[model samples]
Target: MEDINRFGPELALLIAAGLIVVGDVTLPMRGGTRRVASVALGLAGLAVSALWSLVLIVADERGNAFDGLMVVDDFSLFFNFLFVGIAAVIILASVDLLEKSRFRAEYVALVLTSTVGMMLMASTVDLIAIFAALELQAISFYVLVAFLKDGRSSEAALKYLLLGAVSTALTLYGMAYLFGLSGSTNLNDIAAFVAGADSGTRPALVLAAVFLAAGLGFKMAVVPFQMWVPDVYQGAPTPVTAYLSVASKAAGFAVVMRVFVVALGHGLISSDWSNMFAAIAAISMTLGNVAALAQSDIKRMLGYSSIAQAGTFLIGLAAVAANDPQLLLGTSSVVFFLGTYAFTNLGAFIAIIAISNKIGSDQIGDYAGVARRSPWLAAGLTACLLSLTGIPPLAGFWGKFWVFNAAVRADLVWLALIGVLNSVISAYYYVGVVLKMYTQEPANDEAFQPSPYLGLAMTAAVVGLVAVGLYPAPLLDASESAAAVLG
Candidate 1:
């Protein structure tokens, strides 16, 4: 009964997914009615799942499920709420975008199912479980990216699929090496073996670390592994791109932190992985900001910006220390950042969806005079952009504050310095979008109204941003609690 209780949230969502599919086929609706029913069914399932997560959150008792392959802990519950909230928002933003799309029900089902995979990724304690969860998330995204059935969408899907295959192979090989060394797939057992391994085994461990980083790094969009981001972002539907930017990256970081911190954290080669991550962080931040400056398309620019954001978040991983009194600080910073980032990035994308729907173009110049067109969207975008630039008193600012503070506490001052400098470089591009919206001439003078769906989504994100910004203590405490259970 306890095991069943622990598995309740995932079970709720999986069953909901099946019902959504059945409703789509059996309903008597046609065209728009069918689409609306599909969305309603999807949202109902997500609501049930989220409410179940809340119950688990209140329970707060930690233990394992699925014969120890899955763990029900605060950390996993934190991500459960986070992923469900994200999927709900994505569905809200996607409904109108999909009004004309064929197979709309399947699209919503995939998103729901993908959220299930991400939640499992955070919940799992075994390597095989992790891989299965990751592939489930990736496969859904592959189809989501290509849903438009256009040449660009098809091309983007192909690139994403090809690269994803390579990443999966790397992850599998690395897991094999770890299993060979520890003679177990369990992360805690791997950590025990790694801590006592001899010099000869150290080289193998280092190789495994390299493979692990390369594989998981692809999902997070770190520098060398980031080639797929801009193209995929530019090609996919805007709402789907938003989902990729925040939710997908959050899952990647979740598993990365779990694997590295739990399995390889106490080994002799720990510093080797830390130093390598430090270098990757510096390069990814610098290059991502520089590359973003060259983009004229808003979606593509944000794509590069997401890569830079990943580097900042990576600092938390590099700072984790098993013996330190402030060990939770680094991991907690990531949880907090992801919370705020979900609001910040989603605000930006929802605005883009609303504005682009009106103006019918994604070029920066097309956004000129947006304040004159839609003051609500313009102001919302401004808040999110400045927040992303790390300005004070907004959600984004607090996010950077917590993470950099974590780094300093961990004695990673140099990494924090690089991150700060990169912030300045990013400001130039981020604010340039602002300048265009306010100062440049509008390509179209007439203002059009935004859809209510978009308006509601944008309002929710902005409200969350302000709420978190004004009172960060709740999220901070929640993050600390979530971080406490790491192996």
Candidate 2:
């Protein structure tokens, strides 16, 4: 029992993935077996997550684990639970979508495997562990993005693979440099070596760091490395799109936070990295918003929107480098924003999936007069869109407000101001979606019936958005504790 507890939540997901594969292959034929298998996998995942959370509550404060390859600190634990929760929600959301498509078993298995990969990424404190975990997630996503077996899906997967391979190679090369410099792959050892190194070695270390940053930046979809986002988001399945927007992005941030704050913060590296990140943040936000303004495809628009959000998260990272109290605030803000963003984005995709099933379109015009056809879905979408717009009393507003407040507190007042302006600019497009849903008359007054599962998913998301907007204290507090663990 203690040994099982030692492996903690990570084992649950791996076991669940294995169970899903075996059950799919061994189960006798039944009418709803596929759905049952998916549900069982989700339940198993949830159970593991709950147990892991309990461990976090009950376990001692010792953070290091797995021979210092991982850390079971509050920061990692927070994201561990978050990844599991998101995976569970995705599993629920995927049931209807998967049943309608072929390759149901493979989809469920891959998602579970991806969740496990993300969990490992969040917990690890070693560079080798980071690379292995990232590959685990990346390989699963390659299959997931191309699961549809369509030309567009194939193209998206190929593009993602080619780019991902390059990033991986770059990251590996960077790691080799660090390993050569420190003579160890352990993050703690690397930090100590950098702290003690002379000026002669600084340039090499900086170069390696730059390459590593670029590789991770691609994962976060930061500017100059975000070229693949719109196409991948537009071409992948809706559920995969949601997963990419939420789980994958969160995993990237987890690695960034650990790598920068814990590993690099103790080094002799100059403060120049902060300025570089500030520049990246500015470019990412401006470019993402500007590009999104022209997108007619809803998924592509959301993809660009996600890029802007990535910039905001980077602002949090920049704050950490400044050693400002705002780092705490920024960490909390990022966590809250990610939580609400997951719910809202997933809600929007749920609506899209439901409507697309009925109308077979992903164009913005297809959403016109959606309220008349499916009021429940339209209303849910309205809430999500409003949240995305950062409208008052919606979940997104508070997330943005906290994030900008952190930037201001960190004395990046200009960045905060720009973010606010971008938030306002975003409102135009989000409201356009809403107005099209409510004001325009449907070309055909055809009634739309939504799947019961999808309807329930949307309902839960709507409730989440409202509830989180009204009372953000609990989530904020949790994030605050998580941030302290990082410190």
Candidate 3:
């Protein structure tokens, strides 16, 4: 019963996914009606799970299930809420776009199923379990990316599948090495082994870390391993792109923290991984920003932008590996930044969805005089872009502030400087979009309104963004508490 209770949230979501499938097959309904029904079912499941997670948080419930394969704690709970919330928002925002699809119920099922994997990724403590969770998520994404069945979507899914296979192999090979070194799969046991391992194991450990970093780097969309990002983001459905940007990346970082901070943060090789991540961070930021400067497509631009933001995230992860007094701050900064970013990035994409639904174009030039076309959408997108630029009194600003502060505190001043410069470089494009929206003349002045569902999603995201920006303490404190669990 205790084990079952610990698994409640996942179970609820899984049951809902199953029911969505069953109802889709069993019930007779039109495509549009079925999509609405599926969305309702999916949202109900997410709500139940989210409420249960809240109950656990309030009761201070914490425990390990499956003999420590999966753990329920503050860290996992934080991500649980985050993943569920992202899934709900994505579902809501996708309904209009997906209304005409024949298999919309399957779409919702895939989202719920993938979200379940993401939650497990944050909760699992065993290498085997982590691998399973990652695959569960990746496979669902493979299908989601191609769900549109258009030529571009098909090509993107193919590329994603190929690259994803390579990453999986790399991750598995690294896990093999770690198991060979530690003779265990459980993170706690592995940590115990790493603490006492002699100097001879250093070379093998470094190799393992390299492979692990490369594999996870694909999911996080960091440089060199980020070749697939622009193409995939451009080709996939916009709502899927939004979900990938926030929820998928967060899960990758969650696993990185687990494997790196929990299992490998012992005395040996700490500096090695820190230096590696710092180098990757610098390169990713510079490359991503430089590449984003020339992109004409909004989705492609955001794709490159996400790579740069992922690099900033690594700044905090690198700081966590510093093994200094700033460890807590570093981890918490990463968590808090992810939260704020969820609001900022999702708002940007949701607004884009609303705008593009009417304009029927993704080119940056198409956004000209959007303020005149749809004032609310222009304002929302502008606010999100400003946040992404790390402008003051906005959520993105505080996210960058905390991460950079953590970097400075951990003595990564050079890396922090690189981050700041990249942020400046990023502003050129982010603000360029804002400028085109407000300053340029409209090609045609046919004003349109966003659908009620889209308006609700955008309003919720923007409100969260502004609220978090004005008073960051709640998120900051929550992040710190979650980071403490890792500590």
lDDT winner = 3
| Residue pairs that clash (backbone atoms under 3 angstroms), model 1 | none
Give Cα-based local distance difference scores for all models: 0.88, 0.82, 0.94
Model 1 lDDT tens row, 1-487: 8887888888888887888788888878789888888788888888888888788767765688889999988889989988998888899999777887878888998898899899999999899999999999999999999999899989999999999899989989999998988899999889899889888899999998899899999998897999999999999989999999999999999998889887888768877887788788888988899999999999999999999999999888777752356668888898899999999999999999998888888898788899887788899999999889999899898899988898888888999999999999999998998888888777667877678888888888999999999989998898889888884
lDDT tens digits, residue span 1-487, model 2: 4444645687877777777777777887564877776677766766776687576668664466767787777777778778877777677778876776757777887887898888888888899999999999999999999988899999999998999889989888888898988898888887778778888987888878788888888888898889999999999988898899889999988887777766666556635566677789888988898899899999999999899889887776776666545557767777778777877888888888888889889999988898998888888899998998888798888888888878888888898888888887888888899999999999788888777777877787788889989998887888888888766
Our tally of clashes for model 3 stands at: 0
Local lDDT at 216 for model 3:
94
Superior candidate under lDDT, 1 versus 3 = 3
**Model 2 CA lDDT for position 304:** 95
Clashes in predicted model 1: 0
Instruction: For candidate 2, give the lDDT of residue 468.
Output: 88
Off by over 4 Å in 3: none
Q: How do all models score by TM-score?
A: 0.98, 0.95, 0.99
After aligning candidate 1 to the native by TM-score, how far in Å is the CA of 155 from where it should be? 0.6
Instruction: Tell me the deviation in Å of residue 82 in model 2.
Output: 1.2
Candidate rank order under TM-score: 3, 1, 2
| Comparing 1 and 3 on TM-score, the stronger one | 3
